[model samples]
Target: MNNEEKYKKNIHHIHDKSYKDLYSKREVALDLFKNISNANWSKDLKAEDLTLVNNTYITADYEEREADIVYKANINNSEVVFYILLEFQSSVDYTMPLRLLFYMCEIIKEYAVNAKHKKYDKNVKIPAIVPIVLYNGEQVWDVPNQFRKMIYNEELFGNNILNFEYDIFDISNDEKLNKDALIDLKNVTAAIFLLDQKMDAIEFLERIKVIALYFNSLSDAEIKAIKKWIKNTVVDPLAESAIKILEADKREVELMVARNAFILDEMRENAKKEGREEGIEEGRKEGRKEGRKEGIEKSKLEVVRNSINNGLNDDIICKIANVSLDLVKKIRQECEKN
Candidate 1:
């Protein structure tokens, strides 16, 4: 099946547990929020607790309110607990905040009904819902990296109320972080960042050792199946789909590299041959122009001078000039003397 298909399969079991854990704890979300938290993700956040979390969660959940992943954690003296709902996606969802609010409402209704059905359970706390988005897409989905703009309203009179009800952490796929900084992020986050680099899809996926290792942790059967699919869909024949849309661009880049190498090789070969021919011609002409002894000497000097000016390094110039160290030194001395 395709990547989108696999994503929609509800095979949460296939997802990395650490990834799930990070989503629940908001470590990844918080890191991203430091850069991209917006107004939409914080609708129900009453005052302060929604902004931070550092405590033992009562329970982590995924089956709550039809969200992709949700976690119920206890913080704030372990008394005031809240829900941290996380959504993981390859593309952006425009209706996320509204959807999350509706989901929160549904969760409240469910709790109220459940209390009625229960034998003896205390009143439902109506815990706050915090939604975070982990977006991985080629282009940005939202306008601002943060979602603060969504909740604010500009009134006609003076400054209206400021509403930052929710928080969102959009790990921009296109944004490139340095290797050192990338290494510090959660391994999967780093893997996703690396995957966005320009490279062959097959090689790109292979280079992500963490992602591969995480998947490989699955059963042998699951690994075998994933390998087969990747081989066929990503690496084998159709594996070239990564650059399919950008075929011309890819070809142009390859051509540039090859073209440079070819031109350099041609220039070197031609220069070598030209140098030898020039040396021979000067040797002959000098022999004829000057007396035999001086002519031969001038020819040797000409060879040495031209080789030096050819841009070749000293070692290469010496080899091509075919002059001993002493002779080269003498030629240089003679030139300086003249």
Candidate 2:
């Protein structure tokens, strides 16, 4: 499709990979459940208590499906599995409860096979599973958490119908679990949650600065992983040139944050300077010879072009340059050709 369409798809993929990578860390996973989950038992959990369950199993349809973040933990002397499904769609998925049910079934099937359990055996006892959906979408999540809600005449069926509810943490829309709550936890996952939210460049850089303070408790490897996640998820997709600026730093997390801030500030200044100079020249030609409207249009075009060259996306360019979406797309096409 078009660049915009590709960018949107790429963003979803990047978000998936980035979150999976982050939660791959035992400490990050531990922090996520501890800080985010409403379950009171999570407060006493430790990194050593959680074990990552890595398995690739075939679905009922014979398609290979790789499990994302499944963790096995013991709580109150009982085995429990936490299956975390990371969702980053811009809109809500109506079939989320059904999807989670299918995934949970797969997980349980795998567990049953591994445990050598027989159906309806006298000595068989299945471990409890706590399915959780972590959604970071912009839209409000209005979907029912209970699987029975998807079934018609569920109230009539009552106890006869199989009903189970998954815990959902709608990070963006949930008022009780917003960025402020995450920041209060002072963990790497909290910083990640904040950075993942939608914000402008200046605010994002400021957030990077605030996020650096939370890294003091992280190990060297954890710090490295967080930096790489930030680069891959945020910088590479939006401001490509910022990666070069970040690469110039060989110090610690604070220095990396400083470099990111510096990069955005420098890019902003350069865009302003280039837009002004180009606007003046264009205005000299168009304003005197033609009209004031032509000069203004030329000025906005210069800003849009400069923004695009600096690796800013169309949305940001449109806002900063005070130009129409059509104008920005047209200028982007012209720039790509040259």
Candidate 2 regions exceeding 4 Å error are 1-4, 56-67, 75-91, 236-298, 313-319, 322-338
User: TM-scores of the models, in the given order?
Assistant: 0.38, 0.75
Model 2: ten consecutive residues of lowest lDDT: 58-67
lDDT against the true structure, per candidate, is 0.44, 0.66
> What RMSD does each model have against the real structure?
21.3, 4.7
Model 1 C-alpha lDDT per residue in residues 97-130, reported as the tens digit of each score: 5555555566556556765745465553566666
Model 1 spans with C-alpha error above 4 angstroms = 1-67, 112-125, 143-165, 172-180, 186-188, 196-199, 202-206, 209-338
Highest TM-score among the candidates is held by which one?
2
Q: Which window of ten consecutive residues has the lowest lDDT sum in model 1? A: 237-246
**Compared with the true structure, what per-residue lDDT tens digits does model 2 show for residues 202-280?**
5665566555544456566666666777777653434343333333343454566566666766765666666566656
